[model samples]
Target: MIGEREVLTRAQLMAGGLSRRGLVRALNEGVIVRARRDQYVSAAAPSAVVQAVRIGGRVTCLSLLQLLGVFVFANDVVHVHIPRGASRLRSPESVAKPLGARGRRRARLHWWPLSATPPAHSACTGIVDALAHAVRCQPPRQAIATLDSALNKGLIGFADVEDLFALLPRKYRVLRSLIDGRAQAGTETLMRLMVRGLGHEAVPQVHFARFGFVDLVVDGWLVVECDSRAFHSDWAQQVKDRARDLELAKLGYVTLRFTAAQILHQPDDVLAALRGMLGAGRRKPPPRN
Candidate 1:
């Protein structure tokens, strides 16, 4: 059952059956969880964060991600994002301070106001929250991949990203670039990242008449394909890929295919192969423009 959003003002409580003291008394008796002086939740409600949002503060970032099952590896504290100019979120004094082994700077605080928020998806506010957080923390490529997964998993939508891109400041252009860099995850984006990491100026998702879709192509000489079991598991697709490789080779292109496990687990090997190809190509004279 959805909890109530009717926050009781001090005056409203006086007019209702309960007095200020009675409200406090009810809280102490485990009848309600007080999120703020005026905000209270039923004892049977689901989570403190939901109660906080219903009380007026916006839940965002890792807090939202955790609520939506995004598998955040770290960050256990709940983050509450309040609108700017709203009174400070009324958490217990202990919660307001940073959490630590001995109370040092450990727990994170998310007080920044988002000018706007997209609609929720059965508590999938976590996707938007994680996207906002990802912009700041990254090897940009990984963040892009995670965002793609969030979208593929139905955690967020394209409209939400467009809205966010429009809302973020002019100074954050790089974030917009990263957010738009990879539209699909699984293998396509992972290949782009590995190619870039290897210092190859590879164009991603290159379409060739004979090869269908090559994952990355460098100067029309080297074609790299990223294979993931989820997409390339079928024997037919493997055969098609091999036939395409031969066709591409006949057309004067060298094909190098790498599996997802190889790109992710043994990155240096992938880089070395790409570097070798680029170095070999550079040894030849450049074609006239």
Candidate 2:
């Protein structure tokens, strides 16, 4: 019955079959609630996930991040990349404008449009979306992580990475390389910087005999563990990590662990301790089988 009900136009309501007086009477009686002119969401309907969907019903970039369960800290207005040549004012209040188009009025809440068409496939959408936000938002590391998750999960193919990189501004050169180098995981990237800051060569993520696969190996001898609080806080996982560390010790691998905060805020201390370890010849190999 509700589906079949016609949306009465202002003129139609004034014409009598759906009278302006009747519409006013319904609203006063709670029979209908005005959502927007020509747009009415039922009062009992669930709130729409407006941020997750781009204008014109496109999927949003950060919403894709949320869908992929990637960690993101931004809670401000959602970022949406409108393709060039899209209807500029799809909604009068829409936050969309041409990205590179000249002499356009830019507005907050709505971002300028990019010149390319957004991919409809999930992975391509994710990569393009992250790249677009990275360009506007200025956080290289978070952008790189978003790109990494999309790539690692096989959402975006390797071939597309360069194309995305080319679209970025030159100021983000180092960050672009870091993303290209596959330092997709924030934990891994931070740990990599910490090791380098400490004057240690960062080893690739490798399989450790007891610790299973570890975060990063420094000088091929010292195992550097980047512990995210969420993972380390689990009692069972913590017990398992302790057991793994003990085994790693017995096998002659020295362990140095840092929390996320230590890597982010007090990285210099991590570097100093790492420098000491490096200077002390911490390169003893594990016992051979």
Candidate 3:
């Protein structure tokens, strides 16, 4: 059986009884790609795009977001960093399995000269490159999540943002303004930015005595819960969420639950509902429970 990873060296493939001709044929058929002189990565390895990283490119943008365990909203394109002058995107029809939606291109190749050259065989992009690409390539809401996650990990600072932004084109420099390092999840980053846009103070990872740790607290009492399928799809997780909701209600905190799908796809509806709730809540504060 194929392992979770699809990155293979020529020798490894040969050891598995594949002849050189077979390997070449696979490459010709787009079943794999030569990540380097010796390394080969399968196009249809698993859920994530291993082809780009396997073939000496660093994954970036929404691709890196997914790789880093961040909340990614849209990621149909596999993003990879190829050398600015010499490298070419390798996830093409002749090299690896296609990665895009039906009739769309498979991957996004970003040309950048890495500060340190990768080895003859490399598997991933540098953290800095991945982060920079995430900010430059993704939209403001999506980029904020990458920045906030970096901050939460203590990997970057507010001062560092301007410097990084300076390295990018002027168009992407606006990303520096939307950063809030206090965000916990990618969805929380998105939800906080959304609520704050409505002129309300939306603080993230707030603690209530009964509910333990809520995702976001808007205007001191309204709790916003962002549900991710990976984190909360199980029965036990659902029960815990229900219990948290029950306890928060006892403390006069009105909770609004939003799925990642709802937040990403039907944002206008979520925003409208939040606006309506905040409008009425501001009229009269609920008494302490």
The lDDT of each candidate is 0.57, 0.54, 0.70
TM-score-based ranking, best first?
A: 3, 2, 1
Per-residue alpha-carbon lDDT of model 1 for 49-154, expressed as tens digits? 5434443454555556555554333455545555557653343233343233442232334555454454431222345554675545445556566565566667
In model 2, the runs with Cα more than 4 Å from the true position are 1-49, 52-63, 73-76, 82-112, 119-126, 180-184, 209-211, 264-276, 279-289
Model 3, stretches more than 4 Å misplaced?
A: 1-38, 41-50, 53-57, 87-91, 96-104, 153-163, 234-236, 281-289
Please identify which of the two predictions, 1 or 3, would achieve the higher lDDT against the true structure. Answer: 3
- TM-score (C-alpha) between model 1 and the true structure: 0.55
| Per-candidate total of colliding backbone pairs | 3, 4, 2
Per-model TM-score versus the true fold: 0.55, 0.62, 0.73
Q: Cα RMSD to native, each candidate?
A: 8.0, 8.4, 5.5
Window of ten residues with lowest summed lDDT in model 2: 99-108
Off by over 4 Å in 1: 1-110, 118-122, 126-130, 146-172, 175-183, 197-199, 283-289
Global local distance difference test of model 3: 0.70
Higher-ranked by lDDT: 1 or 2: 1
Query: Which candidate number maximizes lDDT?
Result: 3
In candidate 3, the residue pairs with backbone N, CA or C atoms under 3 Å apart (3 or more residues apart, or in different chains) clash, namely 35-55, 100-106
Q: What would you estimate as the lDDT of candidate 1?
A: 0.57
